[model samples]
Target: MTTPLPVFAEPWPEGVTHRYLTHVGATVDVTGGGDRTGYRCTGCIYGSSGQYWHENVAHERAQAHAEKCLALPRPTQ
Candidate 1:
């Protein structure tokens, strides 16, 4: 029999609570204030999208985008 993969656990952010996972697939949902921010791989094998299971190439791409966004100077609000 094949062994089940291990799950990834990240520290819950402050003021943010509640997490759910399922055995049918390898996705984890994190919710706060009725808003579904995004999903993370329970197994850390897939990127933000499960389409790239076992590969975090998409995650890296997302990280690059986020970095660019952060690097951009913000306008006074």
Candidate 2:
């Protein structure tokens, strides 16, 4: 068995969340800090750019894209 990713344990604006889904794969932790207060994902669209949004839009974007990716047809072996 594999260990799960660390989830946000604090309140909003200081929260971080992550998970690995089929077709969507794994994602780096989405977090923020001083002057960089926002969210980011390495396996998402921004992809390591560390693009931070003012709100939790980062999670929405990543989730939306992942859902679409998961819905895609899987290639046969």
Q: What's the CA error at residue 31 for candidate 1, in Å?
A: 4.7
Model 2: ten consecutive residues of lowest lDDT:
68-77
Candidate 2 local lDDT, 1-77, one digit each (tens):
97664453644333554532434443434555334444434344433365566435655555555555533223324
Off by over 4 Å in 2: 1-16, 20-24, 33-48, 70-77
Write one digit per residue (lDDT tens) for candidate 1, span 10-72. 465453333433343233333333222333433343224423222243334433443323122
TM-score of each: 0.25, 0.38
Deviating ranges (above 4 Å) for candidate 1: 1-16, 24-27, 31-36, 47-77
- Among the numbered candidates, top TM-score falls to 2
In candidate 2, list every pair of residues with a backbone clash: none
RMSD of each: 14.4, 9.5
